[model samples]
Target: MKADVMPKPQNMFQAYMLLFLISSGQIGVGIFGFQRIVGMHSDHDAWISVIVAGIVSHIVVGLMFWILSKHESADLYGIHQHLFGRWIGNGLSMVMMVYYVMVSVTIVRTYIELIQSWIFPTFPTWVLSMTLLLLAWYGITGGIRLIAGLSTISFFVILFFIGTLYISPIKYASWSHLLPIGETSPWAIMKGTISMGLTISGFESIFYIYPYIKDKSNGAKYAQYSLLFSNIIYLFMMIMGIVYFSKGQLTRSIWASTSMLKIVKFPFLERLEYIASSVWMFVVIPGLMIYIWVLGRGFKRMMGWKQRMMTPIICFVIFIGSLISQDREHIHMLSTFTGRCALFVVFLYPVVLFLFQTLILGIRDQSDKKGAAE
Candidate 1:
């Protein structure tokens, strides 16, 4: 931790705890919809795009940590002030505030959509929203420690889903279908990588968790590696998605993962997807809670509140926003726009911070050396 950074909530998580929170934030509902998006473009090459996108995000997230690791402690808001003057930093901070809110709202809508599609149709949307909001408020109010504890459990469940792919042999996977990487062009693949990158977008929450880590000195190392873990896990999922979906079968399907499971049969279990997807809340719940917690943290920072004053207000706002989902198209539009906005903070913000910090440090070092020589 940098000398300048203050421990907020006056307590920090162990390295392992921090790692769990970051990874949980990375893993989410993306896995469920991933195969559908991957099948839209190239065949097996979807896996290639997955690797490419993961590498790109990995590099960008590394730069994010490099900028934060330079100062004793700088939240995104603090980094804005460090790089930009007060006015510009203030402006950028507001942009981040909007980004976090949009993210949480979009996720809230998605959660509702999933519940309506899979579990509950007759349940009033408001009732589902309120229940989710209640559960999230409890977790977010407890702070990062609770988030980490929940994530550790979710991580194990998510791993079992990834491992389930192993039960079906890849020898059945057809290669003639996957032979052509780019029947169209490299441009198409790039476009797919950019679009489907949403599946892996959860890694950005490290910005919120940096100050919460017990060891700041090696926090970047831990973050980068945790992201690395996320990348590899995601990559494996993509490969399994491609191989499992096949080529022709994927072309005609709506949700490739759902359709792919149509072949799965056992004496005891008829629909593996039903049972499998039931545990899926493991991924969705923790993911929604994390973004909500980050939203709460932002409120806490801006309001300058005692613990008592801050959390309730934050939870109330999130609960209210959960009612914003009128339909699927609306939620999709919100998610799409928010994801595009996230690109600025995720991809562009760190580069700007790195350049500004480097330039300022160089100037300060020169001034120090000149003064000593005089």
Candidate 2:
């Protein structure tokens, strides 16, 4: 007997959800302590680096949209295959799959470390990692629409959480700490911008997310908006960190944003950082979900595996991998290396891919017109 053939068309998300997805994805575990990363290079002028990184993220987002708009129906995987041959494209896709998995792993591990250091000193990494991964697994299996809705909700939770920044702790901030803004050298500031850019790197999700947008033409506009929004948040946080902590203090702060919350006092709330840190699980989960979902999607397309099946296997691997490093120093090394790798992949690869793809498309268009004329 012949099988029935009417599969439901995949539902696409509205343009505004792009804002939530991109913003939430961008504002992950990185922002919890990004001030120190940038501070290491630019000192108190890290906010300048934050602004520069914002501008740079906008430019990169533009490049990505330009490349993607040229092929609205195709995702990055499809574009890669079209631009390169089948084998080479598949190879690149596998590498990207691994990259996405690594991103999820980094986020999960880093967040667990944050929780362990602050909330539960004796918690096992595998247990927390498994819990977070299981949450991600459930979401990934639910489809992109569910993920987008959760992100939208997470975005509001984060916005409300930002109110905590305005409480008593901020009074301790000395705007004087940010005096002489240009004291750092240009090279140092640029290095700091690189650090900020890594924190802002989740905008690359646009490539995978492009095909799922309902209003494809308006997608870039919302994407640019989301990048700008993420930057503003980063800049605000960086500025606040600089004002609140001296360069010496900031360098010592493992989680600068969380540390800032420690000074907050209210009749009802005793330890604000704990509250903020717990709330941050919402902030970090979207990034993890996006990466995990994309990992499942990538493997499904490449290997004919079901995304539901791939989800558990990926989470298991991530759980096992998270167990390897228990030392704070080792975790730092892993995170640092991942951030640099992400910087190269997120910033440089898109520019290179755009140029090469554009040139190839232009030549093909010219040849097609010439053939038509003949």
Candidate 3:
């Protein structure tokens, strides 16, 4: 199969922006309530699980870069075609596209849930879903360079949200809550790491976005840096959740990160979480745009559908998916299902693909050498 055409110089972005793209992509709505799920298994040692998950992500990302580096100007869709052939590869690519769509839907619905729960109790879900989908559609139409710029801005918005957490949440922390650490068994910590699958899964965007990066050699370096940055933010939030809330409280509080923001009071404003929830749209939109762009690009590469024409169609599908679950139970079910799928797609698949590719190349090389000798 022919390799993908290299993006134009003006369309490509600097290697450094990988830091922002991967970081913003990984730190979405998951951060708000991941503490409860993770803490349920490992308790105070949940932070250790966060570290383990981060290390594992770094290794998986290394595998992804190795795979992409083997073929010039080939993204994940092209790699699939080369490995599995036209029929099977397109099928696999479609699976990935579907997963990306599901992830986008989860982010939109979950964020809208937060908005309705915290700030506006009577807010209609479809209205917010359409509004966010339109914003994401606009960003997708602008192209990858535009999405990269939004990711950069989202990085700073994340910083602002974290900065607000430190001000009030840390004050109420009970350091003793973390006493007698490492009491959790190894098995439970591993379970907690598995539970963290969804929150840390977004860095895999590197697979599709790799071909568009201007500096190929340094791409891995910047991707690792982005993972480290996100891990630090997650670690901080996990530790704070452990200290700020009692064991029962931590497990019960669904939106621990935003719940932590409830205490930040100023002379000017009364409810800080209300403001944080609203500003979180800035962070959510960029992530949604990145995933939708990947979906549209995947269809274009594998099925020859134009990204410009397919983008709005993809957003409409996401909108429909988002509207499927309105209650907390159904939304939780969607997030949980997505998290489990992410474990295989984002983490395990890369290692499997890398090993298979290496083996196939080795066999081909040996055959070529034997033929030349004969």
- CA lDDT of each prediction against the hidden true structure: 0.69, 0.83, 0.91
Off by over 4 Å in 3: none
TM-scores of the models, in the order given: 0.87, 0.95, 0.98
Q: What root-mean-square deviation over C-alphas does model 1 reach?
A: 3.0
**Number of the candidate with higher lDDT, 1 or 3:** 3
Write one digit per residue (lDDT tens) for candidate 3, span 228-249.
Answer: 9999999999999999999999
TM-score of 3: 0.98
Least accurate stretch of 10 residues (summed lDDT) in model 2? 1-10
The residue-level lDDT of candidate 3 at 179 comes to 83
Estimate, for each residue in 144-250, the C-alpha lDDT of model 2 and write its tens digit: 88889988888888778775564565788899888886999999999999877558888788888777787778888998888888888888889888988888989
Question: For model 3, which pairs clash?
Answer: none
Error of 1 at 6 (Å): 2.2
Give the alpha carbon lDDT tens digit for every residue of 1-374 in model 1.
11244776556787666566667777776666665566677566777777777888878878877877777666776666666656777687778776766666666667666657766677687776677667877776677788788998887886777677445635456556556665746666676677565667777777777777777777767767777777787776666566665667666654455445556777898777666655766777787887767666665565454644555665567667767767767776766677677667666677776888899878888999999999
